[model samples]
Target: MATPTTSTGASNKLLLAIIAIFLPPLAVALKEGLTGTFWLNLVLTLIFFIPGIIHALLVVL
Candidate 1:
């Protein structure tokens, strides 16, 4: 018999989402590895906090 394995993707995303609530740019960077989207999120975060959180949630979750 083969042992069953569980995926951690969902839990990782949840953690990212929670991190996004506090630090949107960091979550984006972690998810995207400092890509363009991360840059955009950083800008948004710098401009406004709520939009940053929204963008992070959108990207992470």
Candidate 2:
């Protein structure tokens, strides 16, 4: 049986993954805080959108 925290975490991941498909940087920020990955995602998003989405999905999942 999954604990409440586990269930919530899973749901949060799912939501972040969905968001990653759209706003990659925001998703990365949510998952990883304002760290290097967030900045990397922002740069990737500015350079090319698809790579940012891919990176964000990788980070989230």
Candidate 3:
């Protein structure tokens, strides 16, 4: 049995994970806000796209 909030959070995470595959920075920002993680993700994306995706996944999940 899952609480409503728990299920909703799971769904949100799934959606963000899908978005992270495409736009890692956006996904990080959505999950973590425009914080240092967001800045780091942007920098990682500029330096190497794959690292950015990996970082975003770590932050989100």
By summed lDDT, the worst window of 10 consecutive residues in model 1 runs over 1-10
* CA displacement after TM-score superposition, residue 1 of candidate 2 (Å): 4.6
Query: What 10-residue stretch in candidate 2 is worst by lDDT?
Result: 28-37
**If both were scored by lDDT, which would come out higher, candidate 2 or candidate 3?**
2
Candidate 2 deviant stretches above 4 angstroms: none
Off-target runs (Cα >4 Å) in candidate 1 are: 1-7
Query: Could you say which candidate leads in lDDT?
Result: 2
lDDT of 3 by residue, 1-61 (tens): 9999999999999999999999999999998899999999999999999999999999989
Ranking by lDDT: 2, 3, 1
User: Considering only N, C-alpha and C atoms within 3 Å, which residue pairs clash in candidate 3?
Assistant: none
lDDT of 3: 0.96
Off by over 4 Å in 3: none
Query: Would you list the clashing residue pairs of candidate 1?
Result: none
How far is 4's C-alpha from truth in model 3 (Å)? 1.9
lDDT for 6 in candidate 3 is: 98
Which has the higher lDDT value, candidate number 1 or candidate number 3? 3
